[model samples]
Target: MEEKVYIQLKKKITVEHNHLIKLDHIAFVTGNVPYLEQVKNIKIYQITEQDKNVSVIDGFHLLDTLMVSYPKLAFDLIGPNQVIIEVKKQERKANIFIILFIWLLLCVGSAMAIMNFHYDVSMQEVHQSLSLYLTGRETEKPLWIQIPYSIGLGVGMILFFNHIFKKRFNEEPSPLEVEMFNYQQDLDQYLIHHENVLLKNKND
Candidate 1:
Protein backbone atom coordinates (compact mmCIF):
# COMPACT_ATOMS: atom_id res chain seq x y z
CA MET A 1 0.00 0.00 0.00
CA GLU A 2 1.19 3.52 -0.90
CA GLU A 3 0.73 6.46 1.50
CA LYS A 4 -1.16 9.48 0.15
CA VAL A 5 0.15 13.01 0.75
CA TYR A 6 -2.06 15.99 0.02
CA ILE A 7 -0.67 19.50 -0.28
CA GLN A 8 -2.98 22.28 -1.44
CA LEU A 9 -1.39 25.46 -2.79
CA LYS A 10 -3.42 28.66 -3.28
CA LYS A 11 -4.49 29.28 -6.87
CA LYS A 12 -4.89 33.04 -6.21
CA ILE A 13 -2.64 35.58 -4.50
CA THR A 14 -3.38 39.18 -3.43
CA VAL A 15 -0.42 41.35 -2.43
CA GLU A 16 0.54 44.94 -1.92
CA HIS A 17 3.80 46.82 -2.52
CA ASN A 18 6.58 46.13 0.04
CA HIS A 19 4.07 44.21 2.14
CA LEU A 20 4.65 40.84 3.77
CA ILE A 21 1.84 38.28 3.74
CA LYS A 22 1.23 34.74 4.87
CA LEU A 23 1.81 32.35 2.00
CA ASP A 24 1.42 29.23 4.06
CA HIS A 25 1.14 26.02 2.11
CA ILE A 26 1.67 28.15 -1.00
CA ALA A 27 4.73 29.42 -2.83
CA PHE A 28 4.39 32.89 -4.32
CA VAL A 29 6.51 34.20 -7.19
CA THR A 30 6.25 37.18 -9.56
CA GLY A 31 8.17 39.22 -12.19
CA ASN A 32 10.89 36.51 -12.45
CA VAL A 33 11.92 37.50 -8.94
CA PRO A 34 12.65 34.66 -6.55
CA TYR A 35 10.42 35.17 -3.49
CA LEU A 36 11.73 33.69 -0.26
CA GLU A 37 9.37 32.45 2.41
CA GLN A 38 10.13 33.84 5.87
CA VAL A 39 9.32 31.78 8.98
CA LYS A 40 6.40 29.33 8.61
CA ASN A 41 3.79 31.25 6.63
CA ILE A 42 5.39 34.64 6.02
CA LYS A 43 6.45 35.97 2.61
CA ILE A 44 7.76 39.37 1.51
CA TYR A 45 7.63 40.80 -2.00
CA GLN A 46 8.52 44.25 -3.39
CA ILE A 47 7.18 46.02 -6.45
CA THR A 48 9.38 48.20 -8.66
CA GLU A 49 9.38 49.80 -12.13
CA GLN A 50 6.46 52.23 -11.97
CA ASP A 51 5.69 54.06 -15.18
CA LYS A 52 2.49 53.94 -17.22
CA ASN A 53 2.95 50.43 -18.59
CA VAL A 54 0.14 48.58 -20.37
CA SER A 55 0.99 45.44 -18.38
CA VAL A 56 0.14 47.30 -15.18
CA ILE A 57 -3.06 49.32 -15.28
CA ASP A 58 -4.05 51.86 -12.57
CA GLY A 59 -2.31 50.14 -9.60
CA PHE A 60 -3.10 46.51 -10.32
CA HIS A 61 -1.19 43.80 -12.19
CA LEU A 62 -2.27 40.23 -12.83
CA LEU A 63 0.41 37.57 -13.12
CA ASP A 64 0.36 33.79 -13.32
CA THR A 65 3.47 34.00 -11.20
CA LEU A 66 3.32 31.38 -8.48
CA MET A 67 4.57 27.81 -8.39
CA VAL A 68 4.52 25.38 -5.47
CA SER A 69 5.19 21.67 -5.19
CA TYR A 70 4.91 19.43 -2.14
CA PRO A 71 3.41 15.99 -2.74
CA LYS A 72 -0.01 15.98 -4.44
CA LEU A 73 -1.03 19.59 -5.13
CA ALA A 74 1.35 21.54 -7.40
CA PHE A 75 0.09 24.23 -9.72
CA ASP A 76 0.48 27.87 -10.78
CA LEU A 77 -1.35 30.79 -9.19
CA ILE A 78 -2.84 33.86 -10.85
CA GLY A 79 -1.50 36.51 -8.52
CA PRO A 80 -2.90 40.04 -8.62
CA ASN A 81 -1.41 42.95 -6.74
CA GLN A 82 -2.21 46.57 -5.95
CA VAL A 83 1.20 48.23 -5.79
CA ILE A 84 2.66 51.70 -5.48
CA ILE A 85 3.00 53.12 -8.99
CA GLU A 86 5.23 56.15 -9.32
CA VAL A 87 4.27 58.03 -12.48
CA LYS A 88 6.53 60.73 -13.84
CA LYS A 89 4.71 64.03 -14.21
CA GLN A 90 4.87 65.04 -17.85
CA GLU A 91 3.38 68.48 -18.58
CA ARG A 92 1.01 68.11 -21.48
CA LYS A 93 0.40 71.20 -23.63
CA ALA A 94 -2.94 71.36 -25.40
CA ASN A 95 -4.90 73.96 -27.37
CA ILE A 96 -8.12 74.21 -25.37
CA PHE A 97 -9.67 76.62 -27.92
CA ILE A 98 -9.14 74.11 -30.73
CA ILE A 99 -10.70 71.30 -28.66
CA LEU A 100 -13.71 73.50 -27.87
CA PHE A 101 -14.08 74.46 -31.53
CA ILE A 102 -14.12 70.80 -32.60
CA TRP A 103 -16.65 69.96 -29.90
CA LEU A 104 -18.89 72.82 -31.07
CA LEU A 105 -18.58 71.64 -34.67
CA LEU A 106 -19.62 68.11 -33.66
CA CYS A 107 -22.67 69.38 -31.80
CA VAL A 108 -23.71 71.63 -34.69
CA GLY A 109 -23.17 68.84 -37.22
CA SER A 110 -25.31 66.38 -35.18
CA ALA A 111 -28.12 68.92 -34.80
CA MET A 112 -28.01 69.71 -38.50
CA ALA A 113 -28.19 66.03 -39.42
CA ILE A 114 -31.20 65.41 -37.19
CA MET A 115 -33.00 68.53 -38.45
CA ASN A 116 -32.32 67.62 -42.09
CA PHE A 117 -33.59 64.05 -41.62
CA HIS A 118 -36.76 65.27 -39.89
CA TYR A 119 -37.43 67.91 -42.58
CA ASP A 120 -36.86 65.39 -45.40
CA VAL A 121 -39.57 63.14 -43.91
CA SER A 122 -41.92 66.14 -43.34
CA MET A 123 -42.16 65.27 -39.63
CA GLN A 124 -43.32 68.83 -38.94
CA GLU A 125 -46.47 68.16 -41.04
CA VAL A 126 -47.09 64.96 -39.06
CA HIS A 127 -46.67 66.92 -35.83
CA GLN A 128 -49.12 69.55 -37.07
CA SER A 129 -51.74 66.92 -37.99
CA LEU A 130 -51.24 65.06 -34.68
CA SER A 131 -51.54 68.32 -32.79
CA LEU A 132 -54.76 69.25 -34.67
CA TYR A 133 -56.30 65.84 -33.89
CA LEU A 134 -55.32 66.12 -30.21
CA THR A 135 -56.53 69.72 -29.77
CA GLY A 136 -59.45 69.46 -32.25
CA ARG A 137 -58.60 72.98 -33.51
CA GLU A 138 -56.87 74.31 -36.60
CA THR A 139 -53.76 76.23 -35.52
CA GLU A 140 -50.54 77.32 -37.24
CA LYS A 141 -48.37 75.97 -34.39
CA PRO A 142 -49.47 73.44 -31.75
CA LEU A 143 -47.76 75.11 -28.80
CA TRP A 144 -49.71 73.10 -26.16
CA ILE A 145 -49.06 69.61 -27.48
CA GLN A 146 -45.66 70.41 -29.00
CA ILE A 147 -44.40 71.94 -25.75
CA PRO A 148 -45.32 68.84 -23.73
CA TYR A 149 -43.88 66.58 -26.46
CA SER A 150 -40.63 68.53 -26.35
CA ILE A 151 -40.51 68.19 -22.56
CA GLY A 152 -41.33 64.49 -22.87
CA LEU A 153 -38.38 64.06 -25.29
CA GLY A 154 -35.92 65.35 -22.69
CA VAL A 155 -37.52 63.34 -19.87
CA GLY A 156 -37.68 60.17 -22.00
CA MET A 157 -34.01 60.57 -22.98
CA ILE A 158 -33.00 60.94 -19.34
CA LEU A 159 -35.06 57.93 -18.25
CA PHE A 160 -33.82 55.76 -21.18
CA PHE A 161 -30.18 56.61 -20.55
CA ASN A 162 -30.09 56.74 -16.74
CA HIS A 163 -33.08 54.54 -15.83
CA ILE A 164 -33.82 56.56 -12.69
CA PHE A 165 -33.49 59.83 -10.85
CA LYS A 166 -31.19 59.98 -7.81
CA LYS A 167 -31.52 56.21 -7.19
CA ARG A 168 -31.32 53.25 -9.57
CA PHE A 169 -34.00 50.62 -10.27
CA ASN A 170 -32.38 47.55 -8.63
CA GLU A 171 -29.66 45.66 -10.51
CA GLU A 172 -31.05 46.35 -13.94
CA PRO A 173 -28.55 48.20 -16.14
CA SER A 174 -29.59 51.30 -18.07
CA PRO A 175 -29.73 51.06 -21.85
CA LEU A 176 -26.70 53.33 -22.28
CA GLU A 177 -24.70 51.51 -19.60
CA VAL A 178 -25.50 48.12 -21.13
CA GLU A 179 -24.44 49.36 -24.57
CA MET A 180 -21.21 50.82 -23.13
CA PHE A 181 -20.39 47.56 -21.32
CA ASN A 182 -21.00 45.53 -24.49
CA TYR A 183 -18.82 47.99 -26.44
CA GLN A 184 -16.03 47.65 -23.85
CA GLN A 185 -16.18 43.84 -24.02
CA ASP A 186 -16.03 43.84 -27.81
CA LEU A 187 -13.15 46.33 -27.77
CA ASP A 188 -11.22 44.19 -25.27
CA GLN A 189 -11.68 41.04 -27.34
CA TYR A 190 -10.72 42.85 -30.53
CA LEU A 191 -7.60 44.34 -28.94
CA ILE A 192 -6.59 40.97 -27.45
CA HIS A 193 -7.04 39.20 -30.79
CA HIS A 194 -5.01 41.87 -32.58
CA GLU A 195 -2.27 41.71 -29.92
CA ASN A 196 -2.00 37.91 -30.29
CA VAL A 197 -1.81 38.24 -34.06
CA LEU A 198 0.88 40.91 -33.78
CA LEU A 199 2.87 38.75 -31.35
CA LYS A 200 2.57 35.74 -33.68
CA ASN A 201 3.77 37.81 -36.62
CA LYS A 202 6.72 39.12 -34.62
CA ASN A 203 7.68 35.59 -33.63
CA ASP A 204 7.37 34.38 -37.21
Candidate 2:
Protein backbone atom coordinates (compact mmCIF):
# COMPACT_ATOMS: atom_id res chain seq x y z
CA MET A 1 0.00 0.00 0.00
CA GLU A 2 1.20 3.53 -0.90
CA GLU A 3 1.72 6.18 1.79
CA LYS A 4 -0.99 8.87 1.71
CA VAL A 5 0.03 12.51 1.33
CA TYR A 6 -2.24 15.45 2.18
CA ILE A 7 -1.56 18.96 0.89
CA GLN A 8 -3.51 22.03 1.99
CA LEU A 9 -2.98 25.15 -0.13
CA LYS A 10 -3.31 28.71 1.04
CA LYS A 11 -5.61 31.12 -0.81
CA LYS A 12 -2.90 33.76 -0.91
CA ILE A 13 0.79 33.90 -0.12
CA THR A 14 3.32 36.69 0.17
CA VAL A 15 6.96 36.05 -0.70
CA GLU A 16 10.02 38.26 -0.82
CA HIS A 17 10.80 39.95 -4.12
CA ASN A 18 13.19 38.26 -6.58
CA HIS A 19 13.09 34.93 -4.77
CA LEU A 20 12.54 31.32 -5.79
CA ILE A 21 9.12 29.96 -4.78
CA LYS A 22 8.93 26.58 -2.95
CA LEU A 23 5.89 24.40 -2.31
CA ASP A 24 6.12 24.87 1.45
CA HIS A 25 5.82 28.65 1.05
CA ILE A 26 2.38 28.31 -0.52
CA ALA A 27 1.02 25.12 1.11
CA PHE A 28 1.09 22.67 3.99
CA VAL A 29 2.07 19.05 3.27
CA THR A 30 1.83 16.02 5.55
CA GLY A 31 3.16 12.48 4.96
CA ASN A 32 6.46 10.59 5.22
CA VAL A 33 8.76 12.94 7.15
CA PRO A 34 11.90 12.48 4.98
CA TYR A 35 10.07 12.55 1.62
CA LEU A 36 7.86 15.42 2.86
CA GLU A 37 10.88 17.67 3.42
CA GLN A 38 12.05 17.17 -0.16
CA VAL A 39 8.49 17.57 -1.45
CA LYS A 40 7.98 20.84 0.43
CA ASN A 41 11.20 22.44 -0.86
CA ILE A 42 10.64 21.58 -4.56
CA LYS A 43 11.31 24.68 -6.69
CA ILE A 44 7.97 25.41 -8.35
CA TYR A 45 8.51 28.96 -9.64
CA GLN A 46 10.81 31.95 -9.60
CA ILE A 47 10.12 35.68 -9.51
CA THR A 48 12.75 37.26 -11.75
CA GLU A 49 11.24 40.33 -13.37
CA GLN A 50 10.83 43.32 -11.10
CA ASP A 51 7.68 44.40 -12.92
CA LYS A 52 5.95 41.05 -12.40
CA ASN A 53 4.33 41.41 -8.98
CA VAL A 54 1.31 39.08 -8.84
CA SER A 55 0.81 35.49 -9.89
CA VAL A 56 -2.22 33.16 -9.89
CA ILE A 57 -0.90 29.62 -9.62
CA ASP A 58 -3.04 26.64 -10.52
CA GLY A 59 -3.26 23.80 -7.97
CA PHE A 60 -2.75 21.09 -10.62
CA HIS A 61 0.60 22.60 -11.45
CA LEU A 62 1.67 21.76 -7.91
CA LEU A 63 0.18 18.26 -8.22
CA ASP A 64 2.12 17.62 -11.42
CA THR A 65 5.36 18.71 -9.79
CA LEU A 66 4.76 16.50 -6.80
CA MET A 67 3.80 13.51 -8.94
CA VAL A 68 7.10 13.77 -10.81
CA SER A 69 9.11 13.52 -7.59
CA TYR A 70 6.97 11.34 -5.33
CA PRO A 71 4.79 9.28 -7.66
CA LYS A 72 4.51 6.40 -5.17
CA LEU A 73 2.53 8.48 -2.69
CA ALA A 74 -1.26 8.89 -3.05
CA PHE A 75 -1.65 12.68 -2.97
CA ASP A 76 -4.69 14.79 -2.15
CA LEU A 77 -4.86 18.57 -2.49
CA ILE A 78 -7.36 20.69 -0.49
CA GLY A 79 -8.40 24.36 -0.63
CA PRO A 80 -8.77 26.84 -3.48
CA ASN A 81 -7.95 25.66 -7.01
CA GLN A 82 -5.99 28.82 -7.74
CA VAL A 83 -3.58 30.52 -5.37
CA ILE A 84 -2.63 34.18 -5.54
CA ILE A 85 0.97 35.12 -4.81
CA GLU A 86 2.06 38.69 -4.19
CA VAL A 87 5.60 40.01 -4.05
CA LYS A 88 6.54 41.71 -0.80
CA LYS A 89 8.74 44.81 -1.04
CA GLN A 90 10.14 47.40 1.29
CA GLU A 91 7.89 50.31 2.20
CA ARG A 92 9.08 53.80 1.46
CA LYS A 93 8.17 56.90 3.44
CA ALA A 94 5.85 59.36 1.70
CA ASN A 95 6.72 63.03 1.55
CA ILE A 96 4.86 65.09 4.20
CA PHE A 97 4.22 68.00 1.82
CA ILE A 98 2.42 65.76 -0.68
CA ILE A 99 0.20 64.34 2.06
CA LEU A 100 -0.62 67.83 3.35
CA PHE A 101 -1.37 69.05 -0.17
CA ILE A 102 -3.80 66.22 -0.84
CA TRP A 103 -5.49 66.79 2.53
CA LEU A 104 -5.92 70.50 1.81
CA LEU A 105 -7.27 69.87 -1.69
CA LEU A 106 -9.89 67.41 -0.39
CA CYS A 107 -10.99 69.82 2.35
CA VAL A 108 -11.37 72.72 -0.09
CA GLY A 109 -13.12 70.58 -2.72
CA SER A 110 -15.61 69.11 -0.24
CA ALA A 111 -16.39 72.56 1.20
CA MET A 112 -17.00 73.93 -2.30
CA ALA A 113 -19.21 70.97 -3.19
CA ILE A 114 -21.38 71.53 -0.09
CA MET A 115 -21.66 75.22 -0.81
CA ASN A 116 -22.68 74.58 -4.43
CA PHE A 117 -25.29 72.01 -3.37
CA HIS A 118 -26.79 74.38 -0.78
CA TYR A 119 -26.91 77.18 -3.38
CA ASP A 120 -28.63 74.96 -5.97
CA VAL A 121 -31.25 73.83 -3.43
CA SER A 122 -31.86 77.38 -2.12
CA MET A 123 -31.03 76.22 1.43
CA GLN A 124 -30.52 79.76 2.78
CA GLU A 125 -34.02 80.91 1.80
CA VAL A 126 -35.50 77.77 3.37
CA HIS A 127 -33.56 78.46 6.59
CA GLN A 128 -34.74 82.09 6.64
CA SER A 129 -38.34 80.98 6.19
CA LEU A 130 -38.01 78.61 9.11
CA SER A 131 -36.42 81.40 11.19
CA LEU A 132 -39.48 83.65 10.61
CA TYR A 133 -41.83 80.94 11.94
CA LEU A 134 -39.66 79.96 14.90
CA THR A 135 -38.27 83.39 16.03
CA GLY A 136 -41.15 85.54 14.75
CA ARG A 137 -38.56 87.84 13.10
CA GLU A 138 -37.68 88.46 9.43
CA THR A 139 -33.89 88.54 9.16
CA GLU A 140 -31.38 88.20 6.26
CA LYS A 141 -29.28 85.74 8.26
CA PRO A 142 -30.66 83.22 10.74
CA LEU A 143 -27.44 82.85 12.73
CA TRP A 144 -29.11 80.81 15.49
CA ILE A 145 -30.51 78.07 13.20
CA GLN A 146 -27.91 78.20 10.38
CA ILE A 147 -24.97 78.04 12.80
CA PRO A 148 -26.27 74.94 14.51
CA TYR A 149 -27.14 73.33 11.16
CA SER A 150 -23.64 74.00 9.81
CA ILE A 151 -22.02 72.41 12.87
CA GLY A 152 -24.46 69.50 12.63
CA LEU A 153 -23.52 68.93 8.97
CA GLY A 154 -19.84 68.57 9.92
CA VAL A 155 -20.65 66.32 12.85
CA GLY A 156 -22.94 64.19 10.68
CA MET A 157 -20.19 63.70 8.11
CA ILE A 158 -17.76 62.56 10.79
CA LEU A 159 -20.32 60.12 12.18
CA PHE A 160 -21.30 58.82 8.77
CA PHE A 161 -17.68 58.07 7.90
CA ASN A 162 -17.25 56.61 11.39
CA HIS A 163 -13.81 58.22 11.71
CA ILE A 164 -12.23 61.15 13.47
CA PHE A 165 -8.80 61.13 11.79
CA LYS A 166 -7.49 57.57 12.41
CA LYS A 167 -9.83 56.99 15.39
CA ARG A 168 -13.05 55.02 14.84
CA PHE A 169 -16.20 55.54 16.93
CA ASN A 170 -17.40 51.92 16.79
CA GLU A 171 -16.47 48.46 15.50
CA GLU A 172 -18.80 48.76 12.48
CA PRO A 173 -17.18 49.48 9.13
CA SER A 174 -18.15 52.78 7.49
CA PRO A 175 -19.80 52.91 4.06
CA LEU A 176 -16.53 53.98 2.41
CA GLU A 177 -14.59 51.14 4.03
CA VAL A 178 -17.21 48.60 2.96
CA GLU A 179 -17.13 49.86 -0.62
CA MET A 180 -13.31 49.70 -0.65
CA PHE A 181 -13.32 46.15 0.68
CA ASN A 182 -15.79 45.08 -2.04
CA TYR A 183 -13.63 46.70 -4.68
CA GLN A 184 -10.55 44.83 -3.48
CA GLN A 185 -12.38 41.50 -3.52
CA ASP A 186 -13.63 42.12 -7.06
CA LEU A 187 -10.15 43.10 -8.22
CA ASP A 188 -8.58 39.97 -6.72
CA GLN A 189 -11.15 37.72 -8.38
CA TYR A 190 -10.53 39.39 -11.71
CA LEU A 191 -6.78 38.96 -11.41
CA ILE A 192 -7.13 35.26 -10.59
CA HIS A 193 -9.45 34.50 -13.54
CA HIS A 194 -7.57 36.61 -16.08
CA GLU A 195 -4.16 35.25 -15.14
CA ASN A 196 -5.40 31.67 -15.30
CA VAL A 197 -6.90 32.27 -18.74
CA LEU A 198 -3.65 33.78 -19.97
CA LEU A 199 -1.66 30.82 -18.65
CA LYS A 200 -4.06 28.38 -20.31
CA ASN A 201 -3.79 30.17 -23.64
CA LYS A 202 0.00 30.25 -23.43
CA ASN A 203 0.17 26.49 -22.78
CA ASP A 204 -2.17 25.80 -25.70
Model 1, position 81, has a per-residue lDDT of 23
RMSD of each: 8.7, 2.5
Q: Write down the worst ten-residue block by lDDT for model 2.
A: 193-202
- TM-scores for all predictions: 0.48, 0.87
Over all chains combined, what TM-score does candidate 2 have? 0.87
What is the Cα-based lDDT of residue 126 in candidate 2? 95
Displacement of the residue 149 alpha carbon in candidate 2, Å: 1.2
Error of 1 at 135 (Å): 3.8
How does residue 78 of candidate 1 score in lDDT?
Answer: 45
Clashing pairs in 1: none
Q: Candidate 1 has what TM-score?
A: 0.48
